[model samples]
Target: MQVLAAGGDLAQLTASGLFHGASYGALGAGFALILGVTTRFHFAYSLTYTFTAYAAYSLTAEAGLPFWPAALLGVLAGTVLGVLLELLVYRRVAARSGGDGMMPVFVASLGVGVAGIALLQLVWGSQSQPYYGPSIEPLRAFGASFVNLDVYQAATSVVLVLGLAAALRYTGLGRAVRATRGNPGLAAAQGIDVRTVYLVCFAAGSFIAGVCALWYGLQYTVDPAMGTRPGIYAIVVAFLAGTSASPLRVLLVGLGVGLAEAWSGLWLSLQWTQTTVFVLLVGYLVIRAAGPLLPRRLVGKGA
Candidate 1:
């Protein structure tokens, strides 16, 4: 029984990992927009994700609202907050600092993330808040088990990933985003508002993240620190996919990451989940770093 529960079945592990990866894909989709388009990152963006979940949790738990409406409103609040942070805080910092570099922006983001998590703790306490909404029953088949929520989560992530890719490829805003990502200065010269693109990315990213957060609230528990670890993993996915790549590629990379972690669970303990991600990241970085110096044939370059 213990062996079966761990990683006995490859099919089971792959199914589980794909579902887990769906959440990562949703998160990476949001973060990728900002990182790829605006060329700015906020450690605090994950805080926005947490804030979205808590907002809905508060409405449902405290105000006695239904789960769906509360979640919808929570998404609005989070989206607004994200835009505000970009407009009020990030923009002002950039203006004040004269757009010198990313260092100031990152510092400011880290500071906000710390402060935001602390505030969540103060207001909500340190308890893990789980939703008691409509129970999504577990589904079982092919010697595997999963929940209906996992299906919804995966479907939603797939739609969003495809939507994002289509928008970037075919829409007016997509053109602007691609242009800004490629060369902000040239984009501005072409009459694109780089700042507006940044704002839009924040709003869009935050909204998508909020939706993803809502799924987490339904399926799992929420806490002030809920977004911290997942946020780190999403950042890794964003980098792995890179700026200007197909957003659907983010989904594929996320699935790969999930597979790696899930397979690792076959032998490793539960506590080692995060370590797997970091190990993969480090391995990728090492290979890239060495690729330049290795012989062309060995590196598979000029082939």
Candidate 2:
């Protein structure tokens, strides 16, 4: 109430929320791809992409490379790392364990995440550094201020997400991936190379993660731990959207979460932001869980 009365600028908040929501949606969609197909919880994905952004920013800022080339380098680095991990580590584990090697893969992913963070600390000394791009100046319009870069990022995210979703729905690669996800053995028996699908999925997810990292880097400083919280939130968003949910739903859920997070900051202390988000998540889960039971209970009572 106090913030609103003091000219809180709802429009600005809305724009920020949309931008953040798009970011989260991108993260969620990527993670969903990896999770849905691989069935391996990739904890390292967050840090991996963050490292890519940091490395790319450093290349551009310190190495004197142009932004596009630097960004491409960052994305390629992340994608290669993801594909290598899948091919060298997870694939070997799966081969040894007969494709149910989720435990080894999961543990290895955690170890890799820790190693990535430590390596980043050693190289960057845990400092937060800004990207080399021009400072984002807000464009004021309709009695609201908005950052043009942020809006551009949001648009890019949405388009990429929609495009990926469409590809998954209509393309042959998408069918192969879906087939592999449904049953690797059957897919393999049907002449679809499961390994190839896995490689594609991992690479695609990693590329999306890299894009997300770059966009986030544009908004804030690049730090070793920058992706941690958002990564966790992305997992939650993925679950909320469900594996079979459409891309638009996932995007909408992400946007809702972003809006909630941004709006809460106006009334609550910054420290309480995560707490509020989790509380809302829990409340939503409880409602969703109980919603189905209510109909059953009512039928029983009527009977």
The candidate that wins on TM-score is 1
Candidate 2 least-lDDT 10 residues: 1-10
Overall lDDT per candidate, in order of appearance: 0.83, 0.80
Candidate no. 1 TM-score: 0.93
Q: On residues 148-183, what C-alpha lDDT tens digit does candidate 1 reach at each position?
A: 888888898888888888888899998898899889
Question: For candidate 1, what is the lDDT?
Answer: 0.83
lDDT of 2 by residue, 128-220 (tens): 998866567778765567777887788888987898889888999998988888888899999998888988988988888888888788878
Count of clashes, each model: 0, 0
Off by more than 4 A, model 2: 1-8, 96-99, 284-303
The C-alpha TM-scores of every prediction are 0.93, 0.88
Q: Can you tell me which runs of candidate 1 are displaced by over 4 Å?
A: 1-8, 296-303
How many residue-pair clashes does candidate 2 contain?
A: 0
| Candidate 2 overall lDDT versus native | 0.80
Considering summed lDDT, which 10 consecutive residues are worst modelled in model 1? 1-10
